[model samples]
Target: MYESFFGLAREPFSVAPDPRFLYLSKQHRDALGYLNYGLRRAGGFVLLTGEIGAGKTTVWRAFLEQLPPRLDVAYVVNPKMSVQALLKRLCESLQVELPADADRPGAEADLIDALHGHLLLAHAQGRRTLVVVDEAQALALPVLEQLRLLTNLVTNEDKLVQVLLIGQPELRQLLEHPEMAPVAQRIVARFHLQTLSRDETEAYLVHRLTVAGLTGPLPFEDEAIRRIHRLCRGTPRRINVLCDRAMTLAAERGQLRVDRALVDQAASQVFDLPGLRRVGPGQAARWVAGGAAAVLAVFALTRLLPPWQTAGATVAAASTPSTASAPSSPSAPVSAVPASALAATAVPPSPSAGKHVASAASPASPPPVTASAAPLPHGLQPYDSQAEAGDTLASQVFGQHLPESEAWTRLARRWNPAFTPTADPCAELPRQGLRCHSSQGGLGPVRLLDRPGWLLLTGPDGRSTRVLLEGLQGDQARLSLANGRTLTVPLLKIAPWWQGEFHTLWRSPPAYAGDGVLAADGASGTWLAQQLARLDGGPAQDGAEGLALRIRAFQMAQGLRPDGLPGPLTLMRLNHATGVSEPTLAGSAAAR
Candidate 1:
């Protein structure tokens, strides 16, 4: 109704996930990057959670559009299906043929077989299969278990099917349940979408209006924007609802622009508040006249008081909250909902709230490693809630990579004095000639080490999962999983969850009792120069000054402390950069 009044071509505040009006905030961009990482992985699980109406669907749609043609995607918008029903749906999605003569169990078997065949064909053709289950939080435990079992269908190196699960914040909690560890352990990439910030919310509104063919200034007054933001709490859906109602009310009042009064009146109507009733223009005029008279009376009374009393009265008046408007706070980007807005009241906080705060980082104190991304090793998958893959992790790190169950079997058979099996995989790394080093700030130190390793990903419940780092490619890292998949994640995405701990296998360095010096014309310095030159594509030189500058420059490139000294972190990275071939006794510890 307000489209023509505001000179818009169409409704600007529709609550549809229209890609045309979608705006990518920083969080959204991060979420998309995670999604892309999931897609690039061979096959595993990608878990995405958000509060209701945080634009998960919009981001999903945008991601789907950009997916490569080699990937075939099947979307499950409703996840409340039985195992058999889900199997049938999967068959329908993948276009697998099912025979009519089969019973429910038989049909399920048929569907699985057909899907396996189809996926194998796709694999042979160098294609990929993805099944996206939306509203996954509502999936039954049995069905989730069934989905986990489906991931068991794999080649020696990759899973036949990749699953993408999208749901609300509740899904995160659901995954934290001990019963869901099997499913939870498969998630290689997880990202939670947050609500828009105040600025993003304002930009979202303007972007919508412009998309709806409004080329002039925004129809909303500055005060109206603040009122809307306060009521909507930076949620795009609620913002749209309040804005739509505000515009409707404005059109009803025959106004060309929406102001604070219209927004308040619209909020009252939208929220059904008993104290805030919509009034007519005549009533508003009378209220303004009455307020003016009251102000004049107060001014006269204040004039009779002493100067200090008058100033005190002025301060008190300023302290009073105005019903007409709210002073906008310094725009906080966090997702918060004030109780005044009925719609926003339904939106929950993002899972892992405030975990993304960059300010929590300190240079001296690094974060802890809380999560891991090791995929399910075959033969030893944890079917029970209490089962820990500690023995398997030991085998993967120390012994050869065996399937989870097989790894346990191998651990028992090849038990060595150095290997003590425990439920916690990372409990006893020191015995295996390895050490766990943690840095607080970021990946600069990790990159300086530059070795394939595992990260302990901490969940909200304090349980840690292991994430495997296969290699680093510039600013991103190639992470391998137990499910035979590899994810290329940007360092920025990892920063949010990285607790600053670097855990991997490192050989003990030879004893050297000198100040950490890596640049000189000596044997060690010449080797360091040659390694740095080879690693960085520069000319090999052994001069102390030139090599020190090169070392500093290399440190800077890896996001590490760029001090000129080739410290332990730099030496470790250089040792890894140069393959371990005929290593000098002192430098041999740096080799993986």
Candidate 2:
């Protein structure tokens, strides 16, 4: 209903894990890194653990996206089956057939043989096989042991079959049990996925909007984003739920934008805030106190006092009492006040004052004046959430400063002068390397990515650095450095950037204006110019430089070499970026 009012193509905030709406936060990156590490390691286990609704499944999907073609993957999403059933499922996922009506023992033997054969085949093909069990906590102890035994299928130098166990926090406890010691010890990488931060939450909202084809300011106010982060506590799933509800509410109310009020309303209805009742004891007390005060004031004015009085003397005291007054019959009407005046008096001051007093008098009281009623703990903003955690783990991973955007821009400029200022320059440094940006764009949408066990660090060059997958936490991930340091990344930053083959067709030369700018053709260029004109500052001296930057960004975004040159792939990206029709290029000529 409100789409037209909001100028939206679709609801910007939906809880569904639409791969199109995934936002990879820092925690997600770490989770992906863990998955990657587990898959790459030789014949060892990897564990990923996270809280409920932390986007473990989404992270798993993202990891699948980045899988090398040679790696054979078996994903087990359900873990409630018996050991034999679990084995059968795994085999089925791997396309290994079992004999019909095979008994449990027979099935196990056949499954093992098939697995062994597949592993050998994979080895011959220079590939590795990985078995990922999601919701591993649901697996029985015997089933877990059976899984461990599968790891026994190995070459003399390394185990051929890799296992990944992903589950909630209970899985961690399960692995630590005495009976599961062997399995726990076999884990080579582990990571725990965490929630997004406040800033990340904002980016997450915008990201969803952009992915949904929005090309303007997001529909949510900053305060609304903050409330969402607080209410969701950085959990991707919770954020999605709350945001979806908020959008629905906004649409229902025929509002064009989502604000703090809408988010608070949505969060209150969705997430069960145990101690956050809408009209709790504090509110009740205030209402009661105000009512009592009003009553007391009325009693003092109407019942006890005369219409006029001197300093300590009543009006009647100044005049002698007239015996003729017949003792001023007590039952007689003594005074008359206009009913309008009384009604006016009955209305109390705005509730705002009472709320302020309550908040100031008691620090524990929720601040009513806050943008939203949701409470966000420290260290939970989107950008800070991941970057801070990465920084914590950086010393252990790279032991140095990460590179900055300026460095990457300088490098791109030097490598390809045509890489004009318009290109979005990015660099992937070695282990502990950082990608620098001249001007960092605001946070994008929140989505999940498949990057396993990825960490962000600063290189010795004073830039950022990243440590990919060293630890696992259930099907989610926890970041860790080689030195045993651990950190959590948000889910938004870990989500994969949206791009495909057509991504390159949208590529355009850099335009020196602002981030996310693209110009594929005359129409797109006109649109870009129009959008630039609407900006507070006019377009840069060379809009081409900005276009170049976007192209660079497109290159990095598309997993290209980040050379800042507009090849066929670059052109495709430009087409995608500008939402223009892709132009056909002959053979490899356009690519060059």
Candidate 3:
């Protein structure tokens, strides 16, 4: 349904095991290598294992597509079968003639002799034979031993038959059983496939999109992709289900792009996230964000505290009346009472989570994190060179130190060089059909948004400095000063000074009139009805109650609060998702 709308030749995230859309991540590539090695080595048993929905079958199919010449193959998928049935199936797969009474009892000798005769003939012709068992973990002991016996159908120099066993992780553990010692001795090659990493997950998504005829920019926003990883945990099948649902929902809402809120909404509906799906989308986003921030703050603060400080603070706080109250002693540890923790109980701090984490993790005597004073000599480690290089690149290239405000000017020019800013850049930009968005998060949020923004840095002495973030390359960031000097610094190097604030520009939808609640009246209401029709597939609903219900449904699916009145965040997401021609870090509009 969404293929034409999203400009996709076909659905990109189908869960089917199609080798055509196979993405070879590092571990997946390694898994295929092991399979090929086993084929060449002609081992008695080759083992491949991974979690369910880990794309094992895809890799297996990809490997099976290319087989060497003179190789006869028999494949079995269903594992729940008797040893006699399995043997008969194998003979049938190999095209060996079976007796009319092959199904009769006590015909085991006939089946084995027939298989051996065929194998001997194939071996005489310098051919090899392979038996592949899918879901081999369920194979009974006798059935497994029989396969081992088949491997015994051998010549002096070469084994005539090879068996490959593929299943979930249990198959690997099954081989370690004391009872399966003979089978263990014959495993010449083995590999366990693992889930993709965050980087690999991004690559996997893009690769699949590119293969699905997506030549435009990615349909998934960076944050949406990040959320997909968190929800799916790198499982290929889970990613497929989540992405497909999100796109369909976006398409129905006339959205061309998928964002974090859309992903959360899709996950709430499709996946089994308790409490998330039952509530309004906005509340669920808050719930998830709240929980993550609380956990992150506690963990970050605990890491920054010394053991003695942590223990003292805990004891003192317990001795005090309430966690909300201040300590009696002036010398009490600052951590003795957590003011934010109590406030967070009533209101979640999801938007400011990065700020909280940065503050909590900051040391009391926050050390200076500025780069080296002078350039390092040659032959030092790469990090040292990079650290010193950032300063050098900043100094000699951009010799003048411009205040942070100048970063905004540099950022603005990137979108339009001839554009002149009014008194209030943020306010003025909106009038020009552009917008200024400020967010508090680590480099991750910036990278996800895929925009060049200015970051506010708090110096060791508690001074605020601003630097222009021009671009990012892998782990290195390209930061600029006032006069266009740019330096490449590892992202980690600058993490110490950055306080989670990022300022960037985005294009606004036509006649946006700024951020506010959009009601069920006037031009906004007419527009809302038009947009909702795509999803609701019904006549326009203009009455407050009727329109409110449709609006609420859209909000819930987008993971908004479902206030039944759309606002800036809600409308901006609609613009991005529905193809309003905004600039992105990914370059082009796959959504359009």
User: What is the TM-score of candidate 3?
Assistant: 0.53
lDDT of 3 by residue, 181-200 (tens): 99989998888888877767
Query: If scored against the real structure, what TM-score would every candidate get?
Result: 0.52, 0.52, 0.53
- Model 3 misplaced stretches (Cα beyond 4 Å): 280-592
Better of 2 and 3 by lDDT: 3
Ten-residue stretch with the least lDDT total in model 2:
497-506
lDDT against the true structure, each candidate: 0.62, 0.54, 0.69
* Ranked by lDDT, top first: 3, 1, 2
Taking the tens digit of each residue's C-alpha lDDT, what string does model 1 give over 551-585? 76555434345676876566665555465431221
Please tell me which predicted candidate would have the highest lDDT against the true structure. Answer: 3
Residue-level lDDT tens digits of model 2 in 260-357: 88887887888788633486676567656654554455545555654332212322231234322222322222123222232223222222333343
For candidate 2, the per-residue lDDT at 280 reads: 64
> Cα lDDT for residue 32, model 3?
66
